[model samples]
Target: MKIRCVIIDDEPFARKLLLDYCSRVPQLSVLGDFSNGLDALSFLNHNQADLIFLDIKMPGISGIDLLKTLGNRPKVIFTTAFAEYAIDGFELDAIDYLLKPFDFPRFLKAVNKAFTSFPIEKPAISLNNSPQEDFLFVKDGRDLVKVKLNDILYIKGQKDYVMFITKNRKIMSLMNMRDLEQDLIQKAFVRIHQSYIINTQHIELVASDKVRLNNEYLPVSQTYRLTFREFLEKHK
Candidate 1:
């Protein structure tokens, strides 16, 4: 369920930065990049893309103009230095507007907004584990600790980092929630809220608004409640 995306920016450095950010999220697949709107318009016309990270101002054609020319437009997140174009971008129903020099957290916020508008399909459940591939490394102080997927009781996002809570240890990693969600969703991890991802294997009780895991009640936020309930219904 990767979001196939294209980057359209005149600046090489901006394109590179967006590409790097997109790479970190396992759900995003970069299809192409272009330095000008015309070239991007051509590529988009011939191919299908789910999302676009577009610069508002570019030579030959502005980002707004390029979007207008397209008959079938994908979801767009406008990235530019200009503040004046923000109103216009939103008028056209852009997913988000990222000011130039935005950091990873800001970029991730915009991406999360896009997900709300265009939610990806639920991942296939895979709770079974293999010795070699069922584990992932998380940074804890100076150490990269190996935490088995099945051992993770739940994960909590705090600011720019997420805490991996297992039975014996709580490992903290500098990772965003969106990237973590995509990484663990296939392994029977379900996002109950913007701040919580719970391992389905550890569910003790499911209430109307909260799920009990390891004697801890975690909220199932409105944004994620529908999908989480669907997961439960399918498994039941």
Candidate 2:
């Protein structure tokens, strides 16, 4: 199946360039392109897309603001001329940030990263729904290792892999942060930053900007600060 996509940018030339790039990739199907966030928002409300190529600045609503409005946001690739917004974009877990005037090679690189999360042949790893099972298998190199839920202290995301830090050992897997976040959140795991997710049960302390888990400190990024705060309230 083709991965459905939407492009939201005020620049006609930019949108055209993205369109041209999408056409060359057989795995991508463009849902539509819009000149502003409002129009794109309207289209997205009724339609389902797997990814969005968004601009940081637009007339009606900035891309950052628009992203906040999406409850079930698709994987986003922020396209902008401004370098300052890179931090803001990543805080929201964007797939990649594309600097303006990017060539096809850079665009293709981002698309490949998107495909790693949204594979055409199969879905990412998922937790078993059975209540009795407390462990999930992770693909580490040539072997699939069984890792208990309670054993995980935290998880760290690398480019295409996540290192599962447990009390005794660390297991590496070929997984993306977004997929793992969705699966593990319900199992007492909370994403504290783009690169870190902590097992709440192991949290030793919570500071203003960081959480201490298993004698280690992990930064709580601005994007997840509110969510983590709410989690603390509910559990308290």
Candidate 3:
């Protein structure tokens, strides 16, 4: 299935560039393009899209602000001329951050990363069925690496990619934190912060504002503190 997409940018050239690039990828289909966040938000209220190409800087409502208003967010790729917004975009769980004046090859790479995460169909979730089935295959660069869920200590989100922290090795993949969270939610993994998700089995200690795993300390943000506490109570 082609991924339905929309473009929101204040610059006409940027919008046109993305529209042209979307056409070159057979996996992508353009649903609409708007010059402002409000129009795009209005359209998205009634429409369903798989992806959004958003600009960070805009009049009235910025792309970051628009993301806050979304109830069910589509995969977002932030395009901007400024590099300063990269960290902010990643914090918002964007699929990819594209700097301005990017070539087709770079654009294609970003779209491919998104496609890798948001496939037409997801694999069946049978990881909890048996000990032997409790593993997942993640793309690490050009290779797919098999990681046992039991061996995972924690998962860390670094910008657009996530690192699978295991007992013996750390595997980094081109994936968003949100997408990885969905895949591992049923496997006893919980998000402790915007940048950290830990395997409850490996938790060494729980503190007021952070969690300890082995020798590392991971913060438990207010956003997830209550949920984490409830989880602790239930498990106890």
Candidate 4:
């Protein structure tokens, strides 16, 4: 799945540069761009992102202060003109620190490190001979919850966890979307985008660029559009 990212830098040129750089990376998606930490923090309260490109020296709230406000923080990479904040950034367990005037190659190196550190390990499962298993158990915190495949409407991949969106509730599990896709493909689940896997049976509409699953409008990226079209044709 592409990493959803937000860029927060006080300088307009800096934000634009990061946005342009992110566009060049296939695995990175710019979800929001902000000139200050307050706006970025507000956006995070309602939306989810996988990674953040932050500036350490903002006027009101520093990048370090913003990190402190987050409860379930995403991976962060500090971008600043000063080198002194590198130690503090690392102390907060940031993925990487980039000094201002950094080149594309340097930005890419930091991103690569973030991707490498993200956990996408496959969970252990003993499947039956049947290809269509009705249910499976996933680890959620300290509990092993049994989830019925039929109950799931779609699966949204976060950085390290996949959220199982069922008819009545959402279950968060520590699992990789790619591994889950392999296991569930035989049961009629189709990956319409890097970040979304939909139960074909629940797909309400298929547009040229998006799929409608009930009330949710999930994007169908160019990478998977042709395959999704074929799936629709066969099932229709």
Candidate 5:
């Protein structure tokens, strides 16, 4: 599905950078640009954007302030010049917090996050909702390894290699992010960090900076921060 998005930032260069990157992403179409938060608020009344690239330290109303004022919210990815404000942005449930001078690779990571998040759309959960499946078939050296989904704690991507960490074993394979995500996503899987994908159910605890699953620690990326916060709120 195509994601309609809007850019709201004071800096001209920042807006251009976001616009250029959005052009490269076929799924994203920039519906509008606002130099100030007030203008953004006016645009919001009529425009329906699936995602927003927001600047934290803007004149007039700040990004955090605008977020609070909005009645309906699209997923937010904060872009700020100061690293100190990153924590506060996440606290407000921003999908990702991109530090200034971010590159295209980092920007791409944040955009994909909007696509995978379930909060963007959910239906009534009925008693008849199908039970979550428990396992998957993964190709091993010569045979298909029936990797129990619950047994898996995390999967790490290093260049072209994919490493699977489980309760009983660690398996390595030659794969890319797309291939791995296709095999495991929406089936007890979530990409918490840039180089890591974890089974959220196996997560023992999710701290501010890292995720503890079994005996390993995985760093959560800035882009996936909001989703992590939402994940924690489901329990509370």
Candidate 6:
């Protein structure tokens, strides 16, 4: 089943990054996004989102607080820059915790880990075993690396080549996000900047200007921020 998802981050760049990743995956449809918890809560009462790509800290309501307020809980992946919150987030039964400034491969690992329900690892999300469009082959040196779609965090564009960042590592190749996304297992990837594609699950902070990935940041051009907000709402 396609995971209907929502994004909640105050950062504009962060929102755009997630949107770009979602565009690639066919199954991970974003339902909405929100800058604050209250706004997101209002929408959730009327709509249902399957997966939540949530940020831990915000101005009004932190992500953890919002999650606590809700009874109709969806699968949650917490994003944060501070390692101190890791324990707290996991204590809330978060599916996974992603540190900021994470590359696609690192982000992928968290998602893949989150895909497997903890304690039992039941209700697993596996691209290979699924009956739908499942796998993708990436060019790695002289060999073709077959990557399960769910295992990718984000695809980054660098000049003429693209970097396929996976859960385990990165593989650079002569490819484009446009073409690679065509076969992406889910639409959870978003292009927040011309050079960066981000996995929504790993976002640490969101602002009107740039998305904070831990200490590092990415700029959100005016051209992309507005639509990115709309994208967040859909997933929410």
TM-scores of the candidates are 0.64, 0.52, 0.52, 0.51, 0.55, 0.51
Worst 10 residues of 2 by lDDT: 119-128
Evaluated at residue 133, the lDDT of candidate 3 is 61
lDDT of 3 by residue, 94-113 (tens): 99999998987678668867
The better candidate by TM-score, 3 or 5, is: 5
- Candidate 6: global Cα-lDDT? 0.68
lDDT of each: 0.85, 0.86, 0.84, 0.83, 0.76, 0.68
Summarize candidate 5's per-residue lDDT along 117-216 as a digit string, tens digits: 6433111000112357466555343234666677878888987457878887988654456656655555657777779888888887878888888767
lDDT of 2 by residue, 1-236 (tens): 78899999999999999999888665689999999999999888899999999999899899999999987899999999999999999999999999998987578668768877864532224356678877777755435577889889999998866899998998876577887887787898889899998899999999999999888899999999999999888877
| Shift of residue 7 alpha carbon in model 3, Å | 21
C-alpha lDDT (0 to 100) for residue 1 of candidate 6: 61
- Per-residue lDDT for 171-214 in model 1, tens only? 87666688778877777899999899999999999998999998
Q: Quote the positional error of residue 209 for candidate 6 in Å.
A: 59
Model with the higher lDDT, candidate 5 or 6 = 5
Model 5: residues >4 Å from true position, as ranges? 118-236
Best by TM-score: 1
Clashes of each: 0, 0, 0, 0, 0, 30
CA lDDT, candidate 5, residue 39: 96
lDDT (Cα) of model 5: 0.76
Which stretch of 10 consecutive residues in model 1 shows the poorest summed lDDT? 120-129
Candidate 1 TM-score to native: 0.64
For model 2 the local lDDT of residue 106 reads 72
Evaluated at residue 20, the lDDT of candidate 6 is: 69
Over 4 Å off, model 4: 120-236
True-vs-predicted CA distance for residue 204, candidate 6, Å = 51
Q: Give the alpha carbon lDDT tens digit for every residue of 32-73 in model 6.
A: 988888899888878988778888888888898899988888
Off-target runs (Cα >4 Å) in candidate 2 are 122-236
TM-score of 3: 0.52
